[model samples]
Target: MQDTPSFYYQGVAALARSIQVSDKNSKFVLYMNRADYLDDFKFKKTGVNIEILQSEYYISDVEEPESFPGSLYTLDVIKKIAQAESLDEYIILDPDCLVIGEIDSRFLERHGCNIGFYKLIEGADYQFNKFPFERYGKDINLIGGEVIMINTQGAKEICQAIGSITDRRGLLTEEHYLTVIANQGKIRYCHINTEVKRIWTRMSYRNCADRDYLYKIIHLPAEKKKGIPRLFDKIDFINSHDDLIESIRYFTWLKESVLLDSISKIYRWTKNFRGRA
Candidate 1:
C-alpha cells in the first residue's frame, strides 16, 4: 500500500486482525515509504510477529508521468527487503486485505515455482496492453497484484530483466510486469478456490460470512478511507469469538443505509422523471 497516512490506523488494525488469524509460522512485514511515520505508529496487541521497514529504494526515475510515482516501486522495495534478509520466499499483501482464515503455507510450497499470483479469467486485457510484450516475446495473463508470493531468486532475475528494457514505451504497471514475467514460465498461479474476494461497495459486506474462518482473504481496497472504522467494528466484534449479534447489528445498519441510499436515488429520479425525457 502507498504511504497514505490517513488510512494508516485502519490498515494497521486490519493487519493486526489478519495476523491474529494467519498461520502461526507465517511472518509479516509492513513497508512504509516514510521513515518518520514509524514514530507515531502503534501496532495492536496481536502477539503475531511483524516487522516494519522504511523503504528507501524507489522507481521514480523510471515511472511514467501519468502513473503515481509510488506504484512501480512496490516490487522493487520488496526485492530489496527480501535480499537484505536473505529470505527464500515471501508473500506480499496490500494492507487493506484482511486474513479471515488460516493461510496454508503448503498451498504456496506445493507450487514449487518462482512466483505465485492470483489468476483472473476476465481482466487480462487491461494489463496486457500496457507493456511492450513483443520485445520480450511474452504474452500476458491477468495476474492479480493484491496478494502475491515471491520466490526471492526468481524475483531478482525478473527485476534484472525488467530493468534492462531500454526501449520501454511507458512505465510498466506492477501487475502487468508480473504478468509478463510469469508468462515467461517463471510464475505459478495460486488457485485459492474462491477463498479470496474483493469488496468494492457496502453491498460486499453482505457476502462476508459471520464466521471469519470461512474466507482466506477479504480484500477491502475500496473501503480503505471511510469504511475502515465500520469494518474495524465488525472485525473487533467477530474476533471476540462470540455470538454474531453485534456484528449482525452493524451489518443490518449498513444494509439499511445502502437500501435507504438506493431508495433516495429512486425517489429523486422519479421526481425529475419527465424533465429530460
Candidate 2:
C-alpha cells in the first residue's frame, strides 16, 4: 500500500502479486494522473512488466471528480489507450479488483466479441436506480463498470455513445452509458456473470454466501476504504512466502469485511453523537 490511505492501493498491490502467482505471462498498464505516486509501492514481480500510463484526466470516481478524480473520463482514457497501443482487445479493470485466477490466457480471448462486460448481479434490473437507462434499461441487468473487455472498434463505438449522451439523469458514470450502448446491439457484447462478481460485505447486500473460489476476478468495491488495506497485507504475506492459496482470499474477505463495516458504523455514529453533544 502507498503512504496515504485516501487512495485505494490494494487493487494495485493485488495486481502486482498476481503477476508473481500466475504461470502464464501477463503485463499491465496502470492509468493514473501521476506516475510518481506509485514509487513507494514495491512490486516484486520480476519477468512481467507493469506499465504506468500518466492519465490526462482522473476517472477513478464517478460522482466526485473534484474531491477525487472519478470515472467520468474513463471512456476517453480507455479509447486513447486502445488507439495508442493498436490493441486487438484489452481489459479495463478498476483499482478495487483482484485477480484470483487466469486472466491473460489465450483461451480467455473472445475472438468475435466487441465488448465483454461483467455483470455482478445476474437478472437484477436497474442496478443504478438514479440513471434512466435508455432502452431495455428496466429489463436488463447491471453491467459493472469494473472489468471491461473491449477491442479498438468496440471502444470507439462506446465512446461515441457516451459523448452523444444528452440525458445525464443521474450522476455521470461509465456504467450508465454502457447500459445505454449495450442495448443498441450495434457492438457485439457478452454479459459475463460467473467469472466476475462485485461482492458487498454487508450482510443485507451480500450477493453471495461466501467469496467463491471459482471466480477468476473479484470486484470488492466496498473494501476500498478499510477491508482492502487489511486484505492487501494478507496478500503481501502470502505472496512473499509463495504459498498462493486461493481460499485465503475468501476467508480474509469475510473477516475484514465484518470488522471494517463495524468500525465504519461506529465511527459514523460517534461523529454524529459528537455533533449533537
Candidate 3:
C-alpha cells in the first residue's frame, strides 16, 4: 500500500507517535516558524518522511494581538507552503491530536471533495455563532480545522484565497475562512461522521455513538480548567490499541477485511460499552 501524506505542527511528539504506530509507511510534513526548535527530530526513523517547512504562522503560544497577527496569519502562511508541496493528498492535523492507529488511506482520497471536515456539536457553538451558515452564506453545519485533509487542487485554491485576505477583524479564524470560501464555491465537500467531531464540552463518545456513526478523528483543545485539555490542546481520549483501530475505522471507507477481523474481538465487544452510560 502507498503511504498517506500528512502534516503536523512542531513539538507534537505525541501525535507523531500515533502516526508512526498507525502506519510505518506514512509520510509526515511538519510546520514550524522557527526551524531550530525542531532540528533534533528524525522523521524517517519515526516512520514518517518528515519535511520541516518554514512557518509564517507562529507565536509564543498565545502572545499576540489577541487575535490578529497570530494563528490566522500563521495558518495562512502554512496553507501557502502546503500548496507548494507535491503530494496526492495531505491531512493537516493539529499538534494536540492522537492517531491511536493507522488510518485507511482510501478515506483520505479526494472523492471529488475539495475538503474533508467534521461537523460541530448540534447545539453548542465555538468559532462562529452562526456556524457554516454565517461563514459560508449557506445553511450547512460547520466543521473544525483541527483535522483537515485536502486535495492538491483544493490546497492551492484555499491557499490563494486565504493569502488574499489581509484583514482579520471582519473575518473569522483561518479555519472558518477556508471553509467559507469552499462553501461559497459550493466546493465538493465531504462530511466525516459525528464521532470525529470534537467532544470537549458535555459531549461524550457515547453521545456521539448515539448518532449511529463513528469519527475517525476528534478535536480537543490544549488548555483546560482543572487539567482538562481545551478543545484545541494536544491531548487525546483513546488509550488502547483497540480504541485506536476502532476509532480510525469509524465511518470508515476501507472494507472490513481479514486484517480487521484479526484484531481482538474482546476489544470490539467492550467498545460497545465504552463511552456509554
Candidate 4:
C-alpha cells in the first residue's frame, strides 16, 4: 500500500533463491501485492512450483503500524498465511532473508525439539533497541521477526494471538508481541543465533555480531538495495550455496566508498542489460 511495497522485487529474488537451495518436496509460496509481480523477474527455474499468494488485507480498519521503523502489518501477513495454508511445518521469512543450507530439516527441529522458534535471544538492551522488558517482564527471551519457525499447532496458536493482539500496541511491533508470548510462557524456542543472523549493513554494522558463513539463513534488513539484488541476480542462474557464500560474506562490498558505489551500480546495470539480451 505505502510506496508500492518497495521490497516486492526482493520477494521475487527471495523465492527463486529459496527454491534454488531447497529440495524437490520443499514447496514455496511467494506472497505479494499482485499475481504479476514476477512478470519482470528475469530468471525462471524449470519445475519450480512457486505459488503466488495475494491475500486480501486481513485487518480492514487498522492501517500498517507507521511509527515503528521498518514495520509492516507483518503479523497480519503471517496470520493470512496461517489461515490459508496447511503445511505440516510453518515458517515465515522476510524478503530480506536468504536460505543458508538444507533449511527444510534444520528449520523443522529447534535444538532437537520440534515446535520451537529460531530465536535471537536479546538482552535488556540489544543492539540499539533497548527492549521494554518491564512491559513483557524479565527472564523471558525475545526474538527477531526476520525468520520464524513453528509447527501447525504453534502456527494455529499464533494465528489466534494475532487477531486479538496485533491492534493492541500501536507503536509496538509484532516482534514485541512475540516477546509478550514468550514472557507468558506460551511457546518453546532454541538458540539459533548462528543459524539466522542479521547481516549488519553500513548503517548498523556496530550492532552486528561476528559473521558466520554457515548460517542457516541470512537476514539482511538494511543491506537490501546494495547486496540482495546482486546476490539474488546470480541465483537466476544455476548456483550452489558455495557460490553465494563469498557474495554473502562481502554483502556491503558495493558500499565500500563513493567510487565503489558508482562502479558497482554500473557493473550491475551492465549485468542486467546483458541478461536482458
Best by TM-score: 2
TM-score of 4: 0.68
lDDT of 2 by residue, 1-277 (tens): 1334543566566655654565345566655545566666655543324555544434444445423345555665676755764655567777777666776443225445667887645422244234554534456655678888776777877777666767545445677668666766545677666567776654324444344546777676666666656656666465531354443444445433555666657766787799999
TM-score of each: 0.67, 0.71, 0.59, 0.68
Give a tens-digit lDDT track for model 4, residues 31-135.
554455455554456333455444443333335433453354566566665565554665667777777666655555535543455465452125444457565
Q: How would you encode candidate 3's per-residue C-alpha lDDT over 1-277 as one tens digit per residue?
A: 0111122332254455456555555666565444454445444443444445454544433453344334454365446645565656667776545554455565646355656666565543443333435433556545566677666666666666666656533343565665565555545567755325554322111122323224444443421121122211322443444544454344222223433344434444576578483
Which candidate, 3 or 4, would have the higher lDDT against the true structure? 4
Worst 10 residues of 4 by lDDT: 202-211
**lDDT (CA) per prediction:** 0.55, 0.58, 0.48, 0.56
Report backbone clashes per prediction: 0, 5, 14, 0
Q: Is candidate 2 or candidate 3 better by lDDT?
A: 2
Between the candidate structures 1 and 2, which one is better when assessed by lDDT? 2
TM-score winner, 1 or 4: 4
- Residue pairs in steric clash, candidate 4? none
**Predicted structure 3, TM vs. truth:** 0.59
